[model samples]
Target: MFIFKLLVILTLGYWIMMLGDTLWARKLMRQLPASPKPGGSASTESFASAGLAQPRGTTAKELPLVSVIIAAKEEEASITETVKHLLNQTYPRFEIIAVNDRSQDGTGHKLEELRKWSQGKRQVEVPLTIIHVTTLPAGWLGKNHALYQGFLQARGQVILFTDADVLFQPHALADAVHYMKETEADHLTLTPKIVVNSFWLSAFVQYFFFALSLYIRPWRANIDSQHKHGMGVGAFNMITRQAYDRIGTHQAFAFRPDDDLQLGMRVKQAGLRQRLASGRTQLAVEWYKSLREAVQGLEKNIFSGFQYRVLPAAAGVIGQLLLFFFPFVAIFVLDGWVFWSYVLSIVLMLSVYSLLIQSLIGKIGKELLVFPATVCLLSYIVTRSVWLTLRQGGIHWRGTFYVLEQLKKMKR
Candidate 1:
């Protein structure tokens, strides 16, 4: 009985903290400028219109050249389309470099097809360059190594690292670059609209984002006073060549599965400026085909998010159980103020979730009904990741088995 009361108190306290975080996150989201509508004055929008201080000229010729680097392995399904979207970008001074990271599938052949097609079509404004990597060297992850290879071939002043599966609107890069220049950010990352068809999967993605918002506190990164706060997203991570080189480049965290996040961390640690923006309208990606795929896909980075430590991973699972699961169970089994306390905790949880939905999607829907189940699924994922890492002695990613000891030594 005593333990139950203690649990209720702890759960209530957790929700209270979450309330403050959700509200702050809401404020930050409100301050973020929306991406320009497609085919609606996107080509003519300037820094002055955004009310941000312009560092220099805003003409097409004056803008820094942007080199987009996409590291792909077994990405044949979307590489062609992704490159096609890049070719349509309104940003005049830019190039697309697609690195075929020793892909065993049709990725290389598809890229070659795209290259020939672009040449035949005379799309020289944004030349498409393809680098086929026959092998991955020692002490490097596949994607990171692939990105480094693309970087070596990049000639633009600004570089954008994106995944092969991401889709971009015609004005995505133009708007993003304009925002970065206006804000004078050394590194910029944009959040994509995750397209998940399954109701449960969508719920899980929402819960994941909510948890990330609380854990990383990305809103703090925008505040000039908060130097240590930073954020990154794989869908779109844009950085200047100077800032990229200053942070020691991708080689700094070669073995890390969460390379995108480590890059943001490096930028912050180096005292370079970083900012995150909502790109829901400008960028999108089908995160995973199904829930089963999501579980398998997250295995690589879920444990890494805990720094590959057993204690922290276990604590994360236990914390989720207490905060998300226990309250509902206690509400029905207990009586008196303790019951009411659990009920209030549930209400707070729902309130925090509502704010997150409103901020990210601009509406509240039925996702809240699945939140509890998704929380349980997420906890299982964390447990499975830790267990597999320990039992198999390593993690399997991109057809390579990375030893646990080596990974821990190289953790960021």
Candidate 2:
């Protein structure tokens, strides 16, 4: 009985701490300036005045060369579409370097087809280099190693590292470059609109982002600020040659599974300016196909992404539960004045969550009805994360086993 009371006290304490942190973070987000629009007047002027000449009225300029590097492994289904999207970019001076990372399927043949198509259509004026890495290097993650090899073969002034599943909008490259120049940012990362068709999948993505926004406002804060911490989806990130060199590129985070987050941290540590752009307008990525895939996908990085620090991650999960389920739980679990108190807390939490979701949905032109479902969806993800941490050793992704023991070893 004594132990049970102690456990309850600890849980309640954790809940309060999480709530306080969320409120503080939301307050900070409110105080920050709004995120800049893609290819806006200010962005264009900033880039143009920074020595990169802007294309004259839709006639795209002969801008500095850009190499779009895509690292793929067994991505036969989506590789063709990704390649086609890159080839169709409105930007004139750019090349596509698709690294086939030991794909056992038709990924290699598809790349050859893309090459043949580009040659026939005269779609590619710049060089296109496709390198196949036969073996994985030591102390390096597969994606990072593939990207590093791509970098070695690239001759572009800007190197854009993207995943094989991403479909780019025609103007994405041009707009991204303009924004990079305007912001004087060394690294530019964006959160792509994760496409989800299944009921559970949609809920997972929605709640994930909603909970994230409450704690970390990636879009509003500068990358180098200590108070700023956000996930940089590596699916769509652009880095200048100079900035890449300054931060030592992928080699700096070779062993880290969550290379994007590690790279961002390194950039911050090096005191370089980075910006998070809105990819909701220009980029889309399908994260997973099914619920099991989604669960495994998130598991691989959830623990490691937190640097194997369980306390904060645990607290984060609990906070999310309180924020999302507190209202529903309160109406049934409490009585009299206590019930009303819980009701007010729920109202406050829901109101804040709803406002954030509505604003984001309006900005992206997505359906507003998906907002309420975010709570239910997030609750599942949080629960799954906890279960994965306790029951399973780790998460699986792309046939690789990332266990907690391995993560702890990597930390050393």
Q: Top model by TM-score, which number? A: 1
lDDT of 1 at 1: 89
Candidate 1, which segments miss by more than 4 Å at Cα?
A: 30-58
lDDT score of residue 408 within candidate 1:
97
Error of 2 at 10 (Å): 13
Residue 203 miss distance in model 1 (angstroms): 1.4
Measured with C-alpha atoms, the lDDT of residue 254 in candidate 2 is 76
Which residue pairs overlap in candidate 1's backbone? none
Regions of candidate 2 where Cα sits further than 4 Å from its true position: 1-62, 223-231, 359-395, 402-404
The lDDT, on a scale of 0 to 1, for candidate 2 is 0.67
lDDT per residue as tens, model 1, 273-330: 8888778888989999888899899976699899899999999899888888778788
Query: Total clashing residue pairs per candidate?
Result: 0, 0
**C-alpha RMSD of each candidate structure in angstroms:** 3.3, 5.8
Weakest 10 consecutive residues of candidate 2 by summed lDDT: 29-38
